[model samples]
Target chain A: MRFTLADSRLLRESVNIISELVTEVTFKVSKSGIDLLAIDPANVAMVDFKLTPAAFTEFETEKDMDLSVNLENLKAILKRSKPEDTIIVSLDKDKNRLTIDLTGSGKRTFNLSLIDYDREQQKLPNLKFNAKITVPASKLDDAIADMGIVSDSVALIASNTNFTMKAEGNLSDAKVDFPACDDTVISLGKEEEVMAKYAIEYLAKMARGSKLADEVSLSFANDYPLRVEYNVQGKLHLGFVLAPRVSND
Target chain B: MRFTLADSRLLRESVNIISELVTEVTFKVSKSGIDLLAIDPANVAMVDFKLTPAAFTEFETEKDMDLSVNLENLKAILKRSKPEDTIIVSLDKDKNRLTIDLTGSGKRTFNLSLIDYDREQQKLPNLKFNAKITVPASKLDDAIADMGIVSDSVALIASNTNFTMKAEGNLSDAKVDFPACDDTVISLGKEEEVMAKYAIEYLAKMARGSKLADEVSLSFANDYPLRVEYNVQGKLHLGFVLAPRVSND
Candidate 1:
C-alpha cells in the first residue's frame, strides 16, 4: 500500500491525539482510506479515526492490509515535516518496516520498524445519546483548559436552553455557559437535561483536534461516555469516546 | 525594591538561559541595576547577567539587597506573561517572597518564595584575549544549532581573515565560516589563529540570549574558556564563560 498527502497536518494532528491515549494502534488500509479504532490501555477512552482517499492527493493499494504501528514513533517522524511538505507513506513487506518520505525544500526519509500486535480490534459501541451539541472547536478547547486550571475533572451539563462546563477546586471554581442562541453553538438538542463528569486530562488530549477543525460535535447520555468528534466535511473524521468519572458528591 | 518593565521578554530570556546552567542564583539588586554572577555546580560554565535601571519603565530601590531565588520557579512565573503585559516585580521582605504581577488584558500575579542560597558568589575573572569576533546573534545561533545536530562539541576558530565554527561526529561533520567581509561578521581581530572546543549543550543555552540581542560578541585566547556576550546597547547585558573541552586527539 502507498499513499501521498498534499498536506500532512491532518494526519499529524490525528496521530498526535490518538498517541496520547494509545501508544500502539493497527492502521487498516484499503482503496477507500485508512482507519484506526483503538481503546486506551485503561479502557477508559476509545478513538475512531478515518481518512478517506479524498483526503489524500494520491492513494493506491494493491490489497487491503493491517499495519501495526508505534504511534509515538510515527508522531516523531511527522513532527519533522514542514507545512509545505508532501508526505509519502509505503509499506516495505520484505524489511517489515514502513517508509515515510517528506518532500518540500528537501526530502527526508524515515524507516520505522513495524510491530506485531496481538490485541483484538475494538468495535465501536452503539450508543443512544439523549443530548447532542455542536460548537466551535476553539470554544470547547478554551472551556476545557479553563476548567483544567481549576480542577482535574469537569462536569458537562446540557439543558433545554443551554450547555455548560463547570469545575471546582479548593481555591477556585470556573464555569463556561453557552446558550442555544450563542454563535458558537451550531446545534443543540436535549430530550432531558443531562450531566456527566469526565477527567480533564483525557478531554484536553482530545481537544487537540481543535487545531484541525473549526467545529466539534459532542454527544452523550446521562452518566454515559462522551463522544467528541471533528469532521472535515467529506475529507476526514476523528472521534474520541471518554468514560465518565463517577462523582461521590 | 520595585521595578516595572515595559516588556518582559528580556527578563524571561535571561532567566531561561540562567536556569539551564544553575537551578538557584543570587540576584544583587541596587539602585543602578540588578546583577547576578553564578557558576554551575560542575564548574563548566559561568553566567554574568545585569539589567540596568534604563531597562525598566519604572525603577526604585531604597537600599541594595541580595535575593536568592530558585530559577525554575522564577522561569515558571515568567512563562505566564503575555507579550504586551507590563511586568511589575517587587520584593516582599515581610514574607521573604517575590511578587511578580503581569498586567494587560487581565492581571495575574505569582508569589514565589525566596530561598537562602549558601553558595559563595562567583567573581568575574579578568583575562586578556588575543581574538574577538562580533557577529549577528542569529547567524551564530543557527551555526551552533546545525553543529549540535552532528556533534556534542564545537570548535571555534578565529583567524586573521575568517572566523569559523566546526563540529564533527562519527557519521557527519558541519562547518560554518564567516569571512571578514561577511555582513554577519561585525568585527574580527587576531594576531594569530586561536582555536578552542567547548560543549555544545552550554553554547546552545548561551545562544538563547540571541532572542534578546541583535548581535553577540565572542572573545577567547588560545585554548582558554570562551566568553559569549550579549549587550543590549546600555539597557541589559548577559555574558557566559564556558570552559573548553579537552580533545583526546
Candidate 2:
C-alpha cells in the first residue's frame, strides 16, 4: 500500500494524540475503510479510529492489511519526517518489517518490526451520555493545564448551563468554569448532568492535536471512560477513550 | 507620564517573563529611552530591560516618568487582559495607583497600587567574555530540558570549535553539543574558550521568554553570572544576568 499526503506532519500530529492514552494501535485497512483500535489496560481507555478512502489525501492499496505497532516508536519515526515530506508505507514481503519512506526536501526511511499486539478487542457498550459539548481547544487546553498543576486526575462536571474542571492538591486549589453560553463554548447540549474523572496527564496529551480544530466533541458518563473525538482536516479522525480514575474521596 | 499599546499581550508576556525572574520592576523613563532594572536578593540574578519609543508598537509620552511597581501584581492583572485588548497605563495624582485601562471587546479598569521595591541598579561590569555565540532558543530549551531531568545545575562549555551543555547525576547523564560550524549555529563570534557551571533552574527560566527571539546571545567568563540578552522585535531588548551557583564538588 502507498499513500501520499501533502505533509507528513498531519499524520505525526494524529499519532502524537493517540499515543497518550493508547500504547499499541492496530490498524485494519481494506478497500472500504481503515479502522484503528486500542485500549489503555489500567484506565481501560480505548480509541476507535476510522477513516474512509474518501478521507485520504491519496491512497493506493491492492490488498487488505492488518498491522499493530508501538505507537511510541511510530511517533518517533514520524516526527523525524518533515511536514513537507511525502510519506510512503509498505509491508516488506516476508512481511517482517514495515518500511516507511519519507521524501521531501530530503529522503529518509524507517523500518520497524511488527509484533503480536493483538488483544481481545472488547465491545464497548452503548451508553447514554447526558452531556455533549464542542469547546474551543485553546480554552480547554488552559483549563486542563491549570488543573494538571494540582492533580494527576481532574473531574469534569457538565450540565446544561456550564462546564467545570476542578482539582485540589498541595500545589494548587483551582477550578475553571466556563458557561455553556460563553464564547469559548462552541456548542453545549445536555439531556442531564454528567461527571467523570480522568487523568489530566492523558487529557492534556490528547488536546495537543486538537488545537487546529475549532472545537472538540466530548462524551462522558459517570465512572466510565470519557470519549473525545475531533476531525483534523477531512482526512483525519482522532479520538480517545480514557477510563475514569476511581476518585479517592 | 502615559503610554498606550496596540495589544496588551506583549506587555503581559514581557511582564510575565520579568516577574518570573524578579519580584519587582522599576522603569526609569527619560527623553532618551526607558531603562528597566530588577534585582533578585542573594544576588542570584538580575534583569536589565531597555526600550525606546520606537520599541512601542505606538508611543506617546510628554515628560519623563520614573515609576516602580510590584511586578508580581502587575503580571497577575495583565494576565487577565485579553490578548487583543488595548492597554492604557497612566500615573495617578497620588503617585500610588497606576490606572490601567484595558479596552477592546469590553472596558475594564484596574488600579494597581505601587510598592516600595527599591534596589541599587548597579552598572554591571563589562566582563571580558572568553566566548560568545548566538544559538537558537529551541536548541537551548531542548538541552536545558534534558539537563533538568538529572540535576539542578548545568555546566556549559563554549569555544571556537564547539558549544556543549552537560548535566550529570545518578538518574542519567545528559549532554547536547553543537559544533561551531553546525548548521544550527546562527552565528559564532568568540575570542577565547569559556566554560562555567550555573544553575539550570535559572537558565530554564531565562530561556522561557526567549521563544520570541530567533537566537539569544550568551556571554560568559570564569565563575561569574551568565549574561543572556535577546533583542526582541528589533527594538525592545531584554537582558538577564544570573549569578553562578557554587556547587559542592
Candidate 3:
C-alpha cells in the first residue's frame, strides 16, 4: 500500500486524537478508505476513525490489509511536521515496518517497527441517540477543559431550548451554558431534556478533536454513552464513544 | 510597600527564571527598586534580580523592607496574567499576605500566604572577566536548547575571532558557532581564549531569563563561574551566576 497526502493534518491530527485513548491500533485499509476501531485498555472509551482516499493526493493498494502500529512512535514523527510539509506513507513487508516520509523544504523519513497483534478485531458498540447538537469545536473543547479545572466529571445537559455543561468541586464550580438561539450554537437538539455525566478526563481527551475541525457534533441521551464526532467533510472522520459515569443525582 | 506595573512581563518572567533555581527568596524593597538575590539550595547557581521603579507606573515605599515569600505561590498567580492585564501588588502586613490584583477585562485578586524565612543574606561573588558578549536572546537560548539535546553539559568557547557552544553525546553532537563579524553578535569579546563547561540543566534554567529582553549578555573566563544577564535598562535587571563543571578538557 502507498499513499501521499498534500498535508499531514488528516493523518497527524487523527493520530493525536486516537493516541490519547489507545497506544496500539489496527488500521484496516481498502480501496474505500482506512478505518480504525479501538477500545482503550480500561475499556471506558472507544475511537472510531476513517480516512478516505480523498484525504490523500494519491492512494493505492493491492487489495486489503490490516496493519497494527504503535501510535507513540508515529506521534513522535508527526510532531516534527510543520504546516508546510506533505506526508507520504508506505510499507516494508520484509521488515514489517511502516515507512513514513515528510516532504517539504527537506525530505525526512522514519521507519516504524510494526508490532504483531493478532487479537480479534474490535467491534463498535451499537448505540442510539435521541439528541444531536453541532457547535463550534472550541465551544465544546473549552467547556470540557474549563470543567476539568473544577471537578473530575462534567454533567452534560441538552434540552429543546439550551445545552449546558456544568461541574462542581469542593470549593469551585464552573458552567458553560448556551441557549438554542445563541450565535455560537449552529444547531441545538430538541429532545425535551437529556442529561448524562461523563468523566472529564476522557471528555477532554476526546475534545482535542477540535484541532481537526471547526465544529464538533455531539449525540447523546439521558444516562447514555455520548458520541462525539469531528469530520472534515470529504477528507476524514474522527469519532469517539465515551461511557457515561453513573451518578446518584 | 506598594507598586503597580504596566504589565506582568517584568515580574512574571523574573519569577519564572528565579523559581527554577530557588523555591523561596527574599525581596528587598526600597525607594530605589525591588531587589532579589538568592542561591539555589544545591549551591550550583545564584539569581540576582532587580525590578526598578521605572518598571512600575506607580511605586511607593516609605522604608526599606525585606519580605520572604514562596516563589511557587507567586508564580501560580503570575501564570494567570494576560497580556492586556495590569498587575498591582501590595503587602498586607497584618496578615503577612501578598495581595496581587490583575486589572483588564475584569479585576481578579489573589492573596498568597507568606511564610517566615530568615536565612542570612547572600552576597554575590566578585569576579573580573576578560570576555563579554551580548547576542540576541534567541541566538543563545536556541543554541543552549540544541546542546541540551546531545549532552548533560555544554562547553562554551570564546576567542578574539569567534565564539562557540558545543555538546557531544555518545552518538550525536551539536555546535553553534559565530564569528566576531556575525550580525547576531551585538558585541563579541576580544579575548585570547576563555572557555568553560556548565551543567546544561542549570544553564537552561538561566537561559529562560532571555524572556525579559531581546538580548542576553554573557561574561566568563577560563575555568570560572559564568554570569548571564538579561537587562531591560531602566526597567529591570535579571542575572544568574552558574558554577562551571569540573571538566578534564
List the candidates' TM-scores in order.
Answer: 0.57, 0.54, 0.54
How well is each residue in B1-249 modelled by candidate 3, as lDDT tens digits? 789988887789889888989997899999989999999999999989998899899999999998888887677667767788898888888977677777764345566656778998789999887678777887888999999899999988887768899899999999998777645453334557888899999999888877888888888887889999989977888898989887884
- Model 2 has a DockQ score of 0.05
Q: Which candidate is the best by lDDT?
A: 1
lDDT string, candidate 1, B153-246, tens digits: 9999888778999999999999999887756553444356888899999999999888999989998877889899999979999999988887
Report the lDDT tens digits of candidate 1 across residue range A144-206.
Answer: 876776579989988877888877654334566777765545233435588899999999999
DockQ of 1: 0.04
Q: Can you write out model 3's per-residue Cα lDDT over A1-249, one digit (the tens) per residue?
A: 999888887788889879989998889999999999999999899999999999889999988999899999899999898889988889999999989899999999989988888777688888988778887787687667656655799888888777788776543345566566644353434557888999999999988888898888888888999999999987898999999897884
Listed per candidate, the RMSD to the true structure in angstroms reads 9.2, 11.4, 9.0
Model 2, docking class: incorrect
| Highest-TM-score candidate | 1
Q: Worst lDDT window (10 residues) for model 3 chain A? A: A182-191
Candidate 2 or 1, higher DockQ: 2
Candidate 1, chain A: TM-score against the reference: 0.95
Model 3 clash tally, residue pairs: 0
TM-score of chain B of each: 0.95, 0.90, 0.94
C-alpha positional error of residue B68 in candidate 2 after TM-score superposition, expressed in Å: 19
Q: Write the per-residue lDDT of candidate 2 for residues A1-249, one digit (tens) a residue.
A: 766666665567777777777777788888876778776666456676766666656777888988888889999999888767788877786867789988887888899878787678655556566566677777677667656655678888887777777765542234666666656452334446677788887788777855546678777767766878777666667777776887764
Better of 1 and 3 by DockQ: 3
lDDT of 3 at B151: 95
